[model samples]
Target: MGNICPETYPDPFNFNPDRFIKDGKINPEVTNPEAVFGFGRRICPGEYIAVDTLYVLISSVLAVFDVSVPKDANGNPDIKPSFSIGLICHPDPPKCSITPRSDRHKELVQNLLNSDPTNE
Candidate 1:
């Protein structure tokens, strides 16, 4: 009983996160993916914090970097993506490019690194 069911999520295998959005806001009618944290009284107590942290982390990364499929030697996108099945499902790392979105973003990252005491 995963959230990947076709009845609940159309074309669930495809990475269409925009399905959860409608009119510039999260669509309440869409099934929430919180089932991964369990259900009812047995639900993980840290779920809120975990989800919030993930939102912040992902937003931060997207703000600073441009992530996309990597180009092959011939300059065509190498877009093969697959996942491993288990208790915790996760995508197998695909060939992708992650670069700072701009010179300002790169400088911001450098400034962050320079300010970290542990980096010394």
Candidate 2:
């Protein structure tokens, strides 16, 4: 928890959503709240929006398929990643795999695609 060395952190390392969740719960005690939100009042004014969006995103994902980290050459997911900083900090991409949980989901995706209202 001391000062981190940039040389040690990897760029575009493995992704671990559970890193944001701990003890089967979501709270500051679980992760660095400041890092998730920001430091002090200088934090993003859109914190509320961001939190709500995250809730919806996680809920939606959990309601559907299971998620996991991408295995490395040895078939393990032990990659720790770094982040980018600017006006805002963005997380590095993690290697992972995604697959539909059921045929219902597949059909739903197909239906949405088939009924695309954006079609000409």
Best by lDDT: 1
TM-scores, all models, native as reference: 0.78, 0.57
lDDT of each candidate versus the true structure:
0.89, 0.63
| Span of 10 residues, lowest total lDDT, candidate 1 | 75-84
Q: Which residue pairs in model 1 clash with each other?
A: none
The positional error of residue 117 in candidate 1, measured at the CA in angstroms, is 2.9
TM-score of 1: 0.78
* Window of ten residues with lowest summed lDDT in model 2: 1-10
Model 2, 1-120: lDDT tens digits are 211332332221444445556577874543343455556768778888888999999888766666777676998775677689777667778666666678998687678778998863
